[model samples]
Target: MVASSILSPAIADSLYAQSPFHSDQHDARTGKFWMTSHPTEPGDNGVVPLMKHWGGEVASMWVRDTELLAPLREIGRPRIIEIAVPLATTPDSYSAAKAVVATFGRSIGAIPGKGAFDLYTNQALPPSAVLAIHTEGDPTFVAMGRTYPTGFVDVDAGRWKELTGEDD
Candidate 1:
């Protein structure tokens, strides 16, 4: 939910939409699934590491910068070579949200990206972190500030469609 250059709302939407929560793999890789533009083919690689930790939980894509894009590209999910517009918020707004989320659980920073405000959930995550906040049918949660009600970057839907070819 933290703003990230590595992840985009479009890519996040695709990944979230494509995930089949059940055990889609037979390698005894519980929670393992593929991320592909072609859903029929098995995923290019196992998201086991990401899955083991984030499996069965709604995840917020938090990236520090474009560095996370390589992994996402390797995984073959939707990759936007050029994002028309990315999202951002004032440091004060981010800090305020951080305080609210910190009340429930811990927050972590993103690496290999940019600015340090890329706070994401990791250890000691509370159940509330996975709670959904409907704001355009994108499976959003509340801890992160969306433009609506918070004046943060909500990842403009029109721009997302232009970049990823998916309408919200």
Candidate 2:
């Protein structure tokens, strides 16, 4: 089924401006950031899932609902939903991931070659819970989900390759 709701870029940015999440350089990429929620105390875990139900896509290997809130203190939670926000048609993967953090929220991962990533919040268009952004346009189209865990894994390229059976 298609997503029923979507946010525009302006609204997405506004919401992020009002939230408490913070961004930091990812360990893998020097200039790339990993926007994350402060898990000082338990607040609400429903926000991510609710966004997914509203049209976010499940977009990151590191984004788990269980660990989303307390990222620093934990890891591995049920995969959370993420909204994909378009940044550019030709920007590098790092630029796109940075945009997701600065504009939408922490990026779970960047869309392969698409100038987009799975943003935790503040996404303009709600993508299918099970789809990826198919084409870039107003009310973007979505197709069956395709997992793209880019920049985040580059830091541990060796480990990732061993685990995923990739050859250098």
Candidate 3:
């Protein structure tokens, strides 16, 4: 099924304003800032899945659940959901991780079933930087969180990997 929720780019920027999750406006291909990483679900203990996980660093810019539900209705609000909120970030990946210390409540690995990850933005409309979720069949779940000023794509993968990983 398709996602009911849609992230507005303008709104997402405000959410991560001054934060590190900010992506490079310039089109310079350095690292996999826009690629997928393989990792088990959050809290999987060890075994990370060989799934291509890709998302963004900004969000819908809504602090309250109400403001974020209209778009949610479009996707039927399934049981299992995986959320990733990009926080502030530095120039490099390693530095970005270090900056995340000040931010804790970012990126959530939720569990929601009967759906899949579909809602996305960016030039290619692929998930990047903020608020990402998907649910597709069996095992309903939802993990929603926001990162600090320092955030990176890899770090985002490792932190949320536990949703389906076995190695703590």
Candidate 4:
């Protein structure tokens, strides 16, 4: 995935091993599940958004839907790759921040944590913008000069153009 900071291959491997998907909470105060009261007990499971099978489906959907992306290897069912990227000054560029999320944001099961690619700023996105790439593991590729993914950053699209000397 595209990262805001350059990352070592070893580090991405460890993160993948720990917990790939990121998570968050949504307030449904009027609904059936809400953390209305503070403390009846400590180990309480609240009404939280949930995602299952973070990486597996990410891999599968990348295989199933897009010709743009494919598994780095023929053997591995699940894998994680890290790419070094430039500073995505605009937020929409956040999409470019991570490759896995870029390749399969939809087909993958519920996003991990806030979900896949949650580990980024608002505009951080992949596609269209220029980026430097680095990868470890099986070696997945993202097209920097081609069409962007459906969710690639729009938040910073205008700003990015302004900074890069494009018509805003």
The per-candidate count of clashes, in order, stands at: 2, 1, 67, 26
Q: RMSD to the native, candidate 3?
A: 15.5
Cα lDDT of model 3 by residue, 78-101, tens digit: 322333433232223443343433
| TM-score on alpha carbons, each prediction | 0.18, 0.20, 0.22, 0.17
Q: What is the C-alpha local distance difference test score of each model?
A: 0.32, 0.32, 0.32, 0.30
Worst 10 residues of 3 by lDDT: 47-56
Tens-digit lDDT track of model 1 for 114-164: 112322221333444333323222322221233322444322225556556
Q: Which pairs of residues collide in model 1?
A: 64-113, 65-113
| Model 1 deviation from the true structure expressed as Cα RMSD, one decimal place | 18.5
Relative to the true structure, candidate 3 reaches a TM of: 0.22
Task: Say which prediction, candidate 2 or candidate 4, comes out ahead on lDDT.
Answer: 2
lDDT of 4: 0.30
Clashing pairs in 2: 7-124
lDDT of 2 by residue, 1-168 (tens): 113224445434444443333333233333332232211111134334422332222222234443232321222222332333344422345755554454332245433222333223223343453333222221222211222322232222254455567876
C-alpha displacement of 70 in model 3, angstroms? 7.2
Full candidate order by TM-score, most accurate first: 3, 2, 1, 4
lDDT of 1 at 33: 24
| Candidate 3 positional error at 160, Å | 22
Local lDDT at 84 for model 2:
38
Mind giving the per-residue lDDT tens digits that candidate 4 earns over 1-168? 426333345544544443323212113111221111111111113211111112332222223323222222322232222322334432334444454453354346423221223222224345543333322222232321112233334332354454567776
